[model samples]
Target: MMLPKAAKDPSCGAPKHTGLLREELLVFRHLLGLGENPSQIRLGPPLSNSSLKDILFVSIDVDGPRDFKCAENSPCLVGISILDTRRLQFYMTTISVAAKTRSALGNVENLIKSHQLQVGQSNHLSYRSSKFLFGETRQIKADKVKTYLQRLIKDRFFVLVTYGGGAADCIYLEGLRLGIRPLYHLDVLKVAQFPLQTYYRYSLAKILDALKLPWQDLHIAGNDARFTLHALLMTAVRDWNYRDDKPKSKPTPSTQVTLSSIKTIAKAWRIPDQDQPSLSFLFEDHIIKERVLLNPETRKNGKRLRPEKTPEEKAQRRERKKLAKEKRKLKEARRPQWLFNLGDLLDNE
Candidate 1:
């Protein structure tokens, strides 16, 4: 779906068009790894009829392909995205109540710190600063931070990590999907072989230390995404190491386990299950679809979709066209008159 680009360079000026918020774009780019030069990064066209109204929050799933081990029972991720489209530049951070486990909290702290660094370095100035300088608005409120976070979680942008057993099961599922069989006996290694607790603590502590800064300290989405990715990678790396010694039936490439790779897998797995429908699907799926189809009929019925032109409106349009015609005529008339004048009229008289 087409998504709006974020404002990376304040020098370009605030977007005058209404739609996606600058902050949402920032978060999307961070998730997609597009970063500051998002304009150069082509995205699929904006989802048709999609406006800021449809957007509740944006999310990036950082954990491995499988849903969190206890994802059904507990929240496994945090939701950090924009809350309102009217103020597209602002961000709201949210964490799932189920994700409030000690390990999840650590990830959140790391994510906050990493984001702070990105904002600090990105050339795009903070929204408040831009508003103060260009829009002449007041400073941003401190409370918005918590509010934004809550909105993000409500929007499903964050994820919940499952229990240790679930995580291992997911890994096995990945192996099964790849068509690899165990090379050695399963009895040699324990399923709960990873040191998830240690990784979670280290990653969280690193992030919390970064978030100690003041609100004004964080500005860009790319930075936040980077830090979150860092934490994700740290967790993944540690988990991989923990599983390294285990004799698996089959092993997939490391790249296959990344966020992007998992999305591919998910899509492939989901494609066959999708219900098939016809053109009518457009009417049901899109708000504008029905309107666009009815527009011609409405016009035929003399119920103009747009406001009917008043006599004054018709007169103004006529006057405009007439003036344009007159201007052209005047130019042509001048040329002929000039030629006539250039003739020896005065001498002949």
Candidate 2:
């Protein structure tokens, strides 16, 4: 398999193989037990279309620099989940490419270090789950990611399925101008709407929750890719049954986890610790420069000394100030007597 050509490559023509529709591929993945364990899989009724056998289901997710440009300079982590329907087998893997530039390399290091911190902890699932999830992980230079993908996708009729929009995993491939010719492009995010009857969008984790399937270590490329594939399969099965008007009692449940009550978290799309910094630390001037403040006296030792007060507290403080002013005047009126007492004490000393 040749590496995908740049956008200007004349030899790269339009894709020749356009396989199944998004709808058909979704249903087919479910029936073939694509993402399930072989021991647990009990094959469902086959689809009418025999052509589905020839296609490969490739679901992918990527983790990269926050502001991604070309893949060459920036770091790239590609997670791929492949379902070979023809052979009734599936594989998950990740390809990590280090950035060429110092800044981009720092970003990559921070990302991996962050994930590594949660490795053995129970609180959050980390990329280390990739081993338990039984996926291979490879580290290479940023340029080689495309080559790896090209080799993996060689000659076979394939459908490229992704959790989110084209702007995600697809954009990296397109931005790098890696000439991947997929038989079909499927966005599970869009395909899921009608099947799941949801007007709102879903993240990969949220969708898995809706389907009553278990997902761990999201944003970890391989785990995300694997879950995305499973979500696709489950959504496809639901859509197929809904179209067939199958009885509610005969619903197909996911094989990975027991079909428990479906639960979804609000604001599930936002990853924790993803908020943008209030101040960019890249510029030294931004940190050292004096900032205009309403009360300059309130700032001390580079910290705010004054606490914010309510309206009632302010009124009470004003009343106290008035009392203190009267007391000070009374003390001043007896200043001569106090000075005389001080003189007598000095003489005794």
Candidate 3:
């Protein structure tokens, strides 16, 4: 009897490899300084000083002559990761079909042949990890990708362009600093989908388009990242314009008064006799204090105290105070009280 067919190893190693590849892609993209997709972009408050150090850019590119690869496809996928706000790291992987069928391998071979690039042929997959200071033209395609990625890191905006046939679907991700946390995500999506237009919008686009070179050549991973960055910048400038135009009431005269004038008025209004008196009395005592200060003996104390108001004024004040006190007392007396003992006491009475 066939010894219990050795239990099929449940661990079909393909998943593990795929998982690792996905992680590698994330890291690779991050290192390359690629902007996150519109959905992935995290818009936070002006990053706190503490968090500024951790800010970074990650980008992943899956490039083949075609977008999708079948099980038997041997198309190469180039993944890059760039780290801004710190050092950088770049990684590249070339995957080939593992199938044994002649038909499958034949299809892979034909696809590779169609592209006119060899199965193991390498493109500019290498990259520099130093802080990108300044550059005009990059020597390698990867370097050019890195330059665009840096812009995404600094601007906190991204435009994702999905190229299909001859046309492209443009998506812009714009980061915004809102006081609320949850709104940040919602706002970015809203802005990306429907951007506000302004004269500066064109300027932003021009600057971004000029900076993104490889993006213009290959509608691949790097290019998608560059577009995302452009969209973000455009969105940011537009947002700023919107905020500047937001309606606000003109300042009142009292509010707009200069600090120096306020200080002078405060000094002039001080009561010479009263020390830290009520604000109402402070105004009334100002002239009295100035008159007292002119006399010699009053000048000895260098302070003149304002006398209590006339009997009529005081009587009026007392009447107002009594009315206010009675109103407060009446309010307090009328307040409902839920007392457990009230029913029992009333029954006994």
Candidate 4:
């Protein structure tokens, strides 16, 4: 429903534009292009049929591939990915809520690798900011979940990326409440490559397998997050063709209304728990450091996360790398010979 304009404030007798105020006009919606003609502010494509390009995305997943509705119950592992398609940049962080008796902190190195956060061959910024909360009890864990989540997003615009039938309605709604503009890709894997599917709806494992990602920590909360991103990228890039600014396809009629106010829906989300916690504590901050891939030289727990390379494994890896390099060269060779445009090439990358 369209909001009525400028209701009178009870106290000061002023017009309140955005939301109703019992006392005085506090804030207003700035519909810059609004006019007497309804068409003026309403002219735009609906969301159902949007394409991915130059878009910002935040994909989230729970560890153990658990239902988001169960958040109040068991431990919660929250993986958040920030993807900037325009720059081909991806950043990822995962938070796991375990009992104080169990290992609460996850490996920053493995989390990064499993999540596909480190894009390209090194040199990009490796994000490592970690702090801890004392959530030994169920209630405490729930609060911790919210605490870390708010910190992770930090008010940047994001679309809630996830795998499955729905966007885990509660998490999506919660994110919206947090004022994070959440986007959904609930159909990334719906069109199964085969008919008699054995996988769950929008299964992350199956998607990873299709992408040829060497899977590890399948249901691990942190891994699920990075996998969601890698899977999305793989699907998006396959047989890819690019065009500038494809128009949004109209949203399905049933969903058009729900999505219409998505941007402003957060206005009704619960007020933040508190501006700042009564007490602040820092636990751990995992970082990828300078190396994108697991460095054979770096060791954790007196052992490297990546196994020592055998001669055969090394040979096979080299062969695969060589073939990939040759394919890249072949693709470049097929490009139409043109004057080098550094800016365009760099921008596209």
Please tell me which predicted candidate would have the highest TM-score against the true structure.
Answer: 2
lDDT of 1 at 17: 41
lDDT-best of 2 and 3: 2
Model 2: lDDT equals: 0.51
Each prediction's RMSD to truth: 23.2, 21.8, 28.8, 22.6
Candidate 3 residue lDDT tens string, 255-278: 222221212221222122353432
How would you encode candidate 2's per-residue C-alpha lDDT over 210-249 as one tens digit per residue? 7776665677766677667667666654554344333446
Candidate 3: Cα lDDT at 62: 41
| Candidate 4 or 3, higher lDDT | 4
Provide the TM-score for each candidate, comma-separated.
0.21, 0.46, 0.25, 0.36
lDDT of 4 by residue, 114-210 (tens): 2221111212112211111111112224445555556655554444555664355345346335654543243334422211122334366666665
Rank candidates, TM-score, best first: 2, 4, 3, 1
lDDT of each: 0.30, 0.51, 0.30, 0.37
Q: List the residue pairs that clash in candidate 4.
A: 63-221, 115-226, 130-285, 132-283, 159-183, 160-183
What is the lDDT for 198 in model 2? 50
Decide which is better by lDDT, 1 or 2.
2
Model 1, residue 271: what's the lDDT?
12
> Please, what are the lDDT tens digits per residue for candidate 1 over residues 1-349?
2221332334645444422223333323333232332344333232232222222222121222244333322211221222222222111113332223334333332222211111121123334234221012222222343353343344332222222223443342342242322111111012112223211222233332332211212222332322233333333333333333333544343222333221221111111112342122223443332233336756656455676789999999999999999999888876866576766877778
